[model samples]
Target chain A: MQSSYFTGVTTSNGVMQHDFTVGEVTGALWSSKRAECAPLVLMGHGGGNHKKSPAMLGRAQRLVVDGGFHVACIDAPGHGDRPRTAHDEQEIAALREALETGEPVGPIVVRYNAHLAERAVPEWRAALDFLQGVEWVGDEDPVGYFGLNMGTAIGVPLTAVEPRIKAAVFGLHWPEALAEYARQITVPIEYTLQWDDEHIPRESGLALFDAFASEEKTLHANSGGHKELPRFESDSAVRFFVRQLVRPSIPQPDLVW
Target chain B: MQSSYFTGVTTSNGVMQHDFTVGEVTGALWSSKRAECAPLVLMGHGGGNHKKSPAMLGRAQRLVVDGGFHVACIDAPGHGDRPRTAHDEQEIAALREALETGEPVGPIVVRYNAHLAERAVPEWRAALDFLQGVEWVGDEDPVGYFGLNMGTAIGVPLTAVEPRIKAAVFGLHWPEALAEYARQITVPIEYTLQWDDEHIPRESGLALFDAFASEEKTLHANSGGHKELPRFESDSAVRFFVRQLVRPSIPQPDLVW
Candidate 1:
């Protein structure tokens, strides 16, 4: 990962955001200055959002300061700063026309997903490969993973491939729909869902959670649309990462040390 | 259709929403007093929401008053007042449990959609069959159809088999996925799609529109969630239906009778 002495304010947790080029992907890195070597959490944002998006940045700040872990976020392919595909243009045009005239826009959306599916996982893996070699980053094991909707799509496969991602937070996948990839996920997972989601059908989101083979997993769901995750759920996620990375207090032996 | 001196406050447009049972289906009929013999438009609501839902009611009021068409709406099978299926119970339980515990709810969701696919069309046909025998509700030709989301699921097949429906306003279908039914719709169609819709993948929705055989079709796509359609789009539907149903006033020639 090529990190730059970039211009940006240090966050409350002493997390500094810097522009980065990991492998062929361009992204932002948020790392804490206080810790020379810290537990790291890699975040993937939802579809149509970028690494520095408010949600991504907020989580990065929390994890770095509160959880004592460096956090990294990258835009999904054709999203953020990445170049858009030809299909994306056609799809957007079709979509605009549909909105103007009230026609079906399903084909474009489905195609857009398909296009992203082909590249999302591969790109995430590349980002992971770069992070694994970083000195100040916890390159070894127990690195946490945080992804929502689109993040879930890319992160699920990443978890399956990378052994370092010890804990994860994500949801909104149809395990059955993408059986080959969804079934292979076995890391400790925390999946969030919206019960009354307009697009992500409630049942499908739940079903994706069941597809994970992890023995240690939990579902954090609330009542709302795709964007309306309750405030408390973020606390749940923070607690999860802290619990996962910060070893719990060990009972001192009665025999004494 | 069962006509009754229904007890309810009629809207400013004289649109009356009356409860009725068409064969085995229970639904509401929204008609205007000023245009009892005017063009009739049958309406269908999206998933989760029921007939006479605010969205449905508002549209009904608009069409009856501004466009001069009596509108009717019915709950899809296993929706609204219709009895919930056994599968719905399991799906709901699974969803609630999944939300609480982070389990997979995909299978149940997939099963639910499949179950509806089987019954949705047949029930819609039953409603249409009952409507065909009504004296006021045009048993002959030039009838109009309007549906969205689940409405599309039931209405698509209804449009295919019912020859009287001259035009339609609906969408949220994957034609290739449901080729048999989707391919059969030949009437002029106006399909609405939400660009950022989570549940209905954009491509599949577009593909569904493509599956129709209609030569005259328009796509009205918008940027928002599933429920967040722009206000002006309703005016677009009103225009389409009015253009289809209301004949243009002819210029009086000197020699004309």
Candidate 2:
């Protein structure tokens, strides 16, 4: 195992910004005592949270420890040291106003939010580009993605536009638009739902699943509620991603504590 | 196709508290629907939500409409029209306190909340008894469960304690204690996770998945964040549950829109 490295770097996305890279690669060997890179998995956190979110970090750790995948996580726009755009507060106020007026917020508002939430994808792509340009990491290393809530909301759409992502695992959020996006994705994908998740009704989950065009799809249900992370099937996620991204010829090492 | 029926009754501690019966039953013809008897699926909702939560309702709809299974759903304590109990408030306070303290909270808290949430499961059981007493429902119908966030927390532990539930689908939440509980579960199960769920971190998901004892398990990652629901996958969940609960000899009808 190689020692993990953490560095803060500035990247341009039509604007200059700082983001953190949390792993290291050495001469065709990707290693981070904390993570491994067969297919580097980039993670995005939800709205109002950062890459340090307990949930996000938990997933990051899982991808690193169990899946043997290196993770590149970043805070999205209006999140984690990033400045909010002029429309950010305005959009939030509009949502609040819509809620107060009891006016049915239309899909346009949702679309707008989704668009804003994904503003960082360009930056993420740049970061991935920089990673790919690294001398130590292999040039053809596959890339995977994992995003939560708003992260999923933005990431799913990004997946349609960015084809480098080889596989993905999306958690909690599953919207109708995902159907359109799922049709565009060629990578193996996994989607999970929280049965009693009051925040985003289960119908949304059903709709997203119905949208996926992949035959490699799988689903797991645990006996827990929406607020908790799914315990019964998380490791399977690691296994699935590793199996798809890592070279199959390499024997999986027996996991030891 | 059989006509669907809806009725409300009360129960206590796995027994009926009332004798209200509104459907007809023959040797194998059960209740208001003419569909063949299949396993009974019990569904529960989360706090401030009812059995009709879009997610919960959609799941039940899938079970009934697509899976060709019978579903019984009820609002838990302090939820829906059910009266709140002191224990409910206490549990909520405890959860908040735990979160505030940064202490590790697991499925046990969710299970404890479930006990408090549906202090009236007994009443629901009574209703189940009434349904079972009907000629068509059959006394030996297999039983399964599906619950969302809070509903899952409650249902998982209840299913663990009650030997009747043969299988289950737990959405959103994955608790740490699940590894130990997985050992106790003798039925087929599935769990869902949002890779980028903002509400719950992925680490918690890993802790929960590590607990599962089921050998026959699968995980799916859809492209969405936490707040959104996975409506597209509802059919996949229904398909899984149907395979687990419904016998192949019974001709299942196509899903109705």
Candidate 3:
């Protein structure tokens, strides 16, 4: 996995955000020059969202400025800068028509998820391979992951296959294809669960967490919708990664916002 | 809400399983002779399942044999002995076809859920009214609720308007229609969440938990599919109702299994 670095994007803080593409996977890396050889985190975005979405950026900004960690994030297949394949377009069009016509979306969603996971799991691994050797990172950088919704879908399976990631903050939901594979994942994980998600069932979320073969997993559930998780929970997630990857000696903020 | 009892069915454990029709809802009642005028529990089954389904029956059996509670479960609208309406048939057929053809099932599920919720919630309320004054129950009996998937969708709204219900054990997922009404619910709630459900997303399930206005709600999440929740969780739910409704004055079993 080769990468191209463009440091044109500047942030309000001293941290520098750079754009990089490894083949079809496009992602951004945020890091502070002062924080060399810092622990690195891979940010996975939700479905229908890009790597630089407001929510994703908010998290990246905090990790870089407050948590003092280098962060890398990428767009999944057919999302953001990655070109949507013809098959992807067809599926999207069909789903839209069904929704307009008042057809059931469950079956469509299941199939689309399967299709996406087949590609996404591998794509994330490739991005991780590319993110590892950047100048801000080291040959033995302590790696972590944080993502929700579609991000968890990819992260769950990616973590199962790629042992390089030391820890992960995954929450909410995952792909059906990952059912068997989840039992094989023993990564120290911090999984978030929203109490009442309208789209994802509570049982489904718990099932994913239970499937994780990880002996060191903590369930951080809060009251909210799919996107309505509390800031304190994310702060808790930040603290989790710190404790797991970089050691909790770093004084963290009360909130990541 | 009027009721007629037919006591033709009796169980081996001295728990009599009787048939009853309460307005539009038809359900079976399970009662043990040892618990007279005991606390009553209302059982709501998931979609595509009826009152006497193995899962629902197991819950009722536990509440009766161990928890010293009389259990009442009614079929939701368009389920079980209640014949499906023409509209219900059409929607089910379409969903079946979609599943067969690999078409999107989400659109069909949304419509069916909308159709079911419109009638099922009121049906449950009527059943609650009928169950209150039965021969085995007093006019002022304490009532609890247990249901999943479609059950939560109906149980949530039913628990919202019908404050007579003392406590509830609900989980799985809910329909989008319950978003506004959930905030009105103040009853003590015991909700379950499955981690890796294929049909419902985890965030959506958490959103339902967040929507509830209950200040005394506990989220009981487990690892499994929508249908694969561990029995231990259900045992915990039974214990929850016992503590909330009956106060566990009776001896509770070690493992509800």
Candidate 4:
């Protein structure tokens, strides 16, 4: 119900920014919305897009409106407001060269994703620290996390290693990665997949389901192609988040059909 | 793969006069495949078709080869094998009544599916009883079940109440009904949904996901329209069944890129 934007100035380590406002429930303590002792949802975007992607925005709105949660999405290193560094092109070229060599490239891709996840964790931690100081929200709410595609690559490892994130959701990403990370997580999780998504392939989703460790987990299959966000699924995601994060003490009305 | 066919006089229960055998796989038993189980998947024609639906045939073939499951497809109660109990004018009138009242109404359509599922369970039990008397697959092997479309409506509930069924897959049915019955299930399940499916609406698929309770559940999304199986998803279903029932002890292979 309430809205505003805050700019996170660049520090020596990285440039941080929170472009969205806290909702009516979380207020100034948006970042602390998840757990009283935990960090907020550290959202990351997919490739070739910034924090304001329509898909990301739709997902974020569902989390805020239906889940009653606060989110902090940042541009990954070398993405969004942060200017590209000299190594960016080299990093791209190196990836291309690896592909050109026609080697068994699975592990190489995994390692690259791991590096990206590791590099993004510090900024996420800093963002959490900044959220703790905000006046609107308290420090007690639990922190849950989610990301799309490449963002999931970052969020998965960070949530696995970071104790602050108690629950998470990974969308538009391979389920196999989640399966590998499932062993490392002690919290509840929601895994979503597109039935017709050609981009990621359905087998990856199955692999992820096989790997999940949590006793309480859900696999939501909706009708849509890759990158297509049907309204029905968006609504389901919100309810899933609310069920995972919102405390029973909070009286919330149904916001989605 | 072994194959055979059997034909005999119909029983009081209208047992099929013809019986056929498909190939078999060696592994642990699953739903309908118990050592004493002669579980059979029944294929249902979608609409405007008889027992010769190729789409239904494709589904049955997948179950046979990938799932190592048995199948029996018959026309709706009065549709193919059985004699027509009503006139064309009467059937059309009944259809019009159903359309007008927004309720299923017709002498030929008198909730036959529910009865079919109820009847099949005992038949399956008898088949299992017969199989136990034979020397082929041992009782320790897994017995499982599966179905498509209208057959899904019957098979799912039948599997839910039938204890011998270890695992089941349902393709192209109402999600809401599946959700209603999902609460009764205690075995692993695989559900497939097509994102751009032109036949069934998206809401129906979501309703099923909302209701499913299997802890080990997989949902496959594909890009094609209804009745057109996506190659990747179909392959995933085959692998899923093999993983769940055939090789429960073996580690699942990493998803092929």
Worst 10 residues of 1 chain B by lDDT: B248-257
Q: Compare the candidates by DockQ and give the number of the best one.
A: 2
Candidate 2 lDDT over residue span A102-194, tens digit each: 764435345654775456656666667766655434447788877756777777888888889877777666475566887777677767666
The predicted structure with the larger TM-score, 1 or 4, is: 1
Q: Where is model 2 chain B poorest over a 10-residue stretch in terms of lDDT?
A: B23-32
The CAPRI classification for model 2 reads as: incorrect
Q: B199-227 in candidate 4: lDDT tens per residue?
A: 56656764675466665555654434666
Q: Rank the candidates by TM-score, best first.
A: 3, 1, 2, 4
How many Å off is the CA of A242 in candidate 3?
A: 32
TM-score to true structure, per model: 0.46, 0.45, 0.52, 0.45
Give the Cα lDDT of each candidate: 0.67, 0.58, 0.74, 0.54
TM-score leader: 3
Instruction: Report the backbone clash tally of model 1.
Output: 40
The CAPRI category of model 1 is incorrect
Regions more than 4 Å wrong, model 3? A1-257, B1-3, B248-257
Report the lDDT tens digits of candidate 3 across residue range A173-213: 74365567678888788787776776667677767777788
* Best candidate, lDDT: 3
Winner by TM-score between candidate 3 and candidate 2: 3
Candidate 3 chain B weakest lDDT stretch, 10 residues? B248-257
lDDT of 1 by residue, B55-118 (tens): 7888887788788887877777767878886877777677678757756543444455556756
Q: What lDDT tens digits, residue by residue, belong to model 2 across residues B15-104?
A: 221123222211111122444666777776655566556665455555665666766665565766555668777777777787788775
- List the lowest-lDDT window of 10 residues for candidate 4 chain B: B21-30
